[model samples]
Target: MRYLWYLLPWQFSPAVLTVCVLTVALYLRGLLMLKRNGAPVGFWRPFVFFLGLAVSYAVLQTYFDFLAQHSFWVHCLQQLILHHLGPALIVLSGPVLVLREGLPRAGRTGAPRVLREMRLDWLRKPLRLAWRTLQHPLIAPLLFVGLIFFWLIPRVHFATMIDTRRYLLMNWSMFADGLLFWWVILAPKEEQGSAAVGYKVRLLILPFISMTQIVIGAYISLVPWQLYPIYALCGRALAISPMLDQQIGGLLTWIPGAMMSLVGVIVVLRHMMREEEAQLRMSPLRAETPGSSRPSAEVA
Candidate 1:
């Protein structure tokens, strides 16, 4: 029983539980359906999808969340997983088609109908406009970097640290923004069509994100006084001094954030290379037959 406590949620949230459960159920059911239809539901993608979901859930729901509340470094790690690692993995898994397939036929058909019948169809145009605005190439990256800085503001951080609703909102915003930003960066332009941001543009945006994180993390680490004293009052789960806690948290934010951007650059390079290879393959080959009059140097 004592050991069982380790698995229980530090603070239960019905909403989080529902979202996680539904996500898993939908994915698994869709995966099964895809397998039946021979839709090439590969092992790695499902494994990665589940791994991302598991890590995200672990950070938010398990006893680890209790430590996160009382330790700055823990919180930083939690946010890293929630806002970066988890979302990146999930996006890489290419779960969109599977999740769509997982939906009930009634739901797939009736959702838009229900919205129109409810007279909320009027909202679609404005909602799409808002999405387009937020998803603008420039705005998306800026918002992604801005959220990291915003939640770290001392006063704002303090408020979120103590207030459950605000805290949840902060976490959710990071996660949702992460999904949006990574999708823009990683999805093939072919899929996104006109909305797609080019790999070259994403390369530029990633560095911008890294520099801002470095600036803030350096500030937090170098400050003589504690930037986040809330952990001290919360009965720090770790035995480290406040300064050490702050520094560790700062390092976590600084190092991992920058590394994530670097990794993004590498992924972008791979995408560019893949496209180049495809183009080369498709380009007409000039094979010279023995009867063809081609210079030896040119043929070589």
Candidate 2:
């Protein structure tokens, strides 16, 4: 009976709950559109894919993050899902076809109208703004490096540990920033209005970015010194040795997180290459004129 509380499923933060509910609602709306006679069938697959991802996220949060005992590896896994994988998957699963069809029959007239307008001007204003911002070239490299530096800073890391708001804010912000940075570089040219870089370029750039973390982790791992005093306090509170705790946290930050980043870069680079090749193939063919006989030849 004493361990009954631990047996209860994990609880989600309000933000997670809201997102989950919205995802489910959107999925249902898509289904409703399918049933309606006038609605288009374009949105079903994308809606289903996104809905599935949302449900997977919910399960991870409820079963792994909320219910399981606090372990560094578990925390790393959660971060991989909520931060690295989730944002990219959701963005890639944009509701272009589905939203177009579903929103019309969603029974929400205002939203439908707005979405229609957005569909007309989507890339022009909102998405264009985001695209330009993310592709600055400066933003991605800086963010890639800055996140590690900020994480290593004693005050910043400790602040995150002490304040739930700070922890959530820092992690979520970095994750969003990372996704946005990559999105600009990897998004389809039609949507982005500018060709994404070649896959070869991305392969180089992505590895270069990931290497920063490998270096940071190596440095932290080699240093015998304790960078954060809070680790000692946390160790005492949690009844784990301070050195072991710090090492575990460092490993979580270093290995799995870095691997996730590297993997994303690889995938995005591959997509960029395929997009470039497709564009090359689809480009208008140049008209070739056969050599014209000299007019002088007729006179001769």
Candidate 3:
């Protein structure tokens, strides 16, 4: 326990703190409105959201951040938490549904109404365009895969580590993209609608996306030379050598990261099966076609 304490330093990042606080506040406000309106708000939704925020804080503001700065494996662990697990939990919580439901109706006079008015359609054009692009079947999966490759380029990865702005950009982009990718996979059928990627397409694409992670991970793990020179040069915080650390990082990306996509695939498969069963149930029972012996078709 004492050793664990030493591993987790109490670091305060104002920016990260602010974001977490605001996210919690908004979620709480929405939850309260949902309850007041007699909406069926589940306890699990808020729990999942808070859990994600906690994971993000742990990665960004705690000793994890310190270790990540020195250890490639630790950094990979941080990235996985931030970009895969945390974002998946947050998306599952359905923050967009909560926020949309929480907002006041137009022409109403209240803080909620004022906030609603602040949406500013013109200001949202770029964001809307980006969202639409992300929702595209091909674009979302490709972007997810591309982002992994793009940042892994030694020069790009090292540059991000050295520059504060670039580091922040990298982290934010990872989190945002992760959220979007998972959202496409997990959002309800009605929510996905015709505009977004069809369920079957997403399921089909998932394996390919997962394979990319596996390939990247295998490459990093097997390569004899260190890809990121900074990690090699820096004094390692842990006893592991830089080369071993790189291998461990590669393994992390290869295994758990690929598993993340497999989990999505499983979810989609189950959903599709349920939909098929439902359709089977809902289909009208067909009358026996001119059969002399059969009276009527049994009800489904």
Candidate 4:
């Protein structure tokens, strides 16, 4: 039991703590603003948003952090949750909408107005460019896949594990990219107009992305030799054999990661179907059909 306790990675990360606190603060501020304005804030929005934050803190700041550093399989599981599940929940929580509505209204005179104007001026151009770039159907998925490949390179992966800065960068980048990719796919209808890539295009490209992840995971799992030297050089802290650990990691990435991508594909398909149904309902031909009972239908 003491050995197990020794194995636990309980080191505090100031960076992780700061980030988690900021996330909660920002979200709470938005919720407060929403309530002040008499907006109907659903219970689930805050719940899911906070859940994502909690998952992030769990993996980065708790015992899971130690396990991830020591075990290949645990690291893979961490990535899956951080890059796929956690971000999905955050996006679903509708932070963008909440934040937008939460912003104070600008007025002709006062410090609040001045602050608001300055904030808008500072944010407008850069935010617009970022939004445009992310909205491109190919950009988010390609960047996401590219990041996975980039980090999986033996040298890159080893560097990240050895260097604290690099490790933080890897985790934060994956989280940010995950949020962007999922938000592109699952944004509310009012925001869909800003997306450069239509739902059909997003749907078409998703399968290819899923296939790439599967291929990468399969390669890692099937290889006879270990790709990462650090895992071998640094003794395995857990009971599992290095080879078995590598295989488990590969399978986790191959299966659960692909499943998350599949969920995005399903969302896109549903959105397309809904749009098609709406279009059909609004069609003049449908309204004028012989079976229709309205006066306009009878005139037709």
Highest TM-score model number? 1
**Each model's lDDT:** 0.84, 0.56, 0.77, 0.77
Runs with alpha carbons beyond 4 Å of true place in candidate 4? 1-9, 102-116, 119-127, 277-300
Candidate 3 lDDT (Cα, 0 to 1):
0.77
lDDT of 2 by residue, 160-213 (tens): 766768766765666667556556545543443352443455556666666776
Sorted on TM-score, highest at the top, how do the candidates line up?
A: 1, 3, 4, 2
Q: On a 0 to 100 scale, what is the lDDT of residue 218 in model 4?
A: 91
Score residue 264 of candidate 4 by CA lDDT: 84
TM-score of each: 0.89, 0.65, 0.83, 0.82
Better of 1 and 4 by lDDT: 1
Candidate 1 pairs with clashing backbones = none
- Candidate 4 lDDT tens digits, 1-300: 766764444777777778777667766777888788798687998888889878867887777888888899899999888888888988877787676554445432443456566776666567668787876787888988888888888899999989988988999898889888887777655455545456777777778778889998998999999887687678776898788889998998898888887888777787767655654576757645656643322221
How many angstroms is residue 270 displaced in model 2 relative to the true structure, after the best TM-score fit? 3.7
Q: Per model, how many backbone clashes are there?
A: 0, 1, 0, 0
Candidate 1, residues 1-300, lDDT tens digits: the string is 998898899999898899999999999989988989988688899999999889988998889999999999999999999889999888888888789789987555544576786689988778767777777889998898899999999999999999999999998999889888888887766655446677789899899889988998888888999889899987999899999999999998899988999888888898878765655555424222334432321211
